[model samples]
Target chain A: DTAVSQTPKYLVTQMGNDKSIKCEQNLGHDTMYWYKQDSKKFLKIMFSYNNKELIINETVPNRFSPKSPDKAHLNLHINSLELGDSAVYFCASSQDTDGGTEAFFGQGTRLTVV
Target chain B: SQELEQSPQSLIVQEGKNLTINCTSSKTLYGLYWYKQKYGEGLIFLMMLQKGGEEKSHEKITAKLDEKKQQSSLHITASQPSHAGIYLCGADSSNAGKSTFGDGTTLTVKP
Candidate 1:
């Protein structure tokens, strides 16, 4: 079984459209995170949730919202997608609550806005 | 914001050669992590070093954290083509444990 799994491995959407990526982990982790990797391959944390509570939220735009339905799921929903939002989105999970925890990542979902 | 600098941007070497990649932080790090990503893929956890002077190894890959807790190095010995990928170093920042990754190190190994 996949430890962390994400739906829509590839997404192509028009600008101004709304899209959502679903993530689920069977590892029974307490923390989930959403990261975006740009064309330069720089990975940045967009949002993090611990035990269904919002934790670390970087300087991401308000258009990007992360929702944790439970301890095993974290989903990313973007309103009015932009070309700038075209990148690889990753969903990861960690068993720990704080720093210094090893994370398991999903294969990744490539988002392309036309 | 905590900035992380990594180098060299890209590397190519013959198989069986040794290579090293570095990640440094502008601010002190609470913990450091090493991840690998194949082309167009998500980051894969390799290892994590928390305390200063901490060292961890898996197979032919080994990572070391500087005593100052400001820098880290990922070294690969007897490298193979399978080791070719982008290696990223991330840190748990002071403000939060948020992970900020460097640009990346794209590695290519030839037979």
Candidate 2:
């Protein structure tokens, strides 16, 4: 069984459009995160939610929003998408352990904004 | 602190060779995680180290964390064509709540 999964593996949209990507994790994890991988392949954390509560919010723009209705689901929505927003978005979950932790990643969602 | 700095941004090796990738940090690494990713696919977690002077291995890959907690290394033995992909090192500093990630080391193993 897939532990983590993302929807709309690929998305093509125009500027000023709004779109949403859904993610779910079945690992029974307490924390979930959203990361953006740019053309340079740098994985940067955007937001994180734990137990249905927002725990970490990186230096992302206000147009980008993350929502988690339950512990197992976290979704990302972009408003007025821009070309620079074209990149792969990944969803991950982790079980915290001894001042450290490891994340389980989902197959990324490649967003292409024109 | 930039957190984790992975070296050699990319690597190319012929099959059956041994390779090593380095990850240095500004803050002491409370936790170190290694992951491998194929193009356009989700990353697969390779291993994790929380305590200093720890060593873990899976199959032909082994990872080590120094006692200083500021450095870690991933080594691949007898590399194979299937080992081609991007390798990333993630660190959890004492700050917690989030993990800092490296840009990644792209490995290209040619047969």
Q: What is the DockQ of candidate 2?
A: 0.71
List each candidate's DockQ score. Answer: 0.71, 0.71
RMSD, one per candidate, in order: 1.3, 1.2
lDDT of 2 by residue, B1-111 (tens): 357899989999999999999999988888899999999899999999988899999999999999998899999999999999999999888757578889899999999
- lDDT string for model 1 (A1-114, tens) is 999999999999999999999999999999999999889988888888989899888888899999898999999999999999999999999887577778889999999999
Q: Give the clashing residue pairs of candidate 2, or none.
A: none
> Where in model 1 is the C-alpha error above 4 Å?
none
- Give per-residue CA lDDT, model 2, range A1-114, as digits (tens): 999999989999999999999999999999999999989888888998889998889889999999999999999999999999999999999865334767899999999998
TM of each candidate vs. truth: 0.95, 0.97
Quote the positional error of residue B49 for candidate 1 in Å. Answer: 0.7
How accurate locally, in lDDT, is each candidate? Answer: 0.90, 0.91
What is residue A72's positional error in candidate 1, in angstroms?
0.8
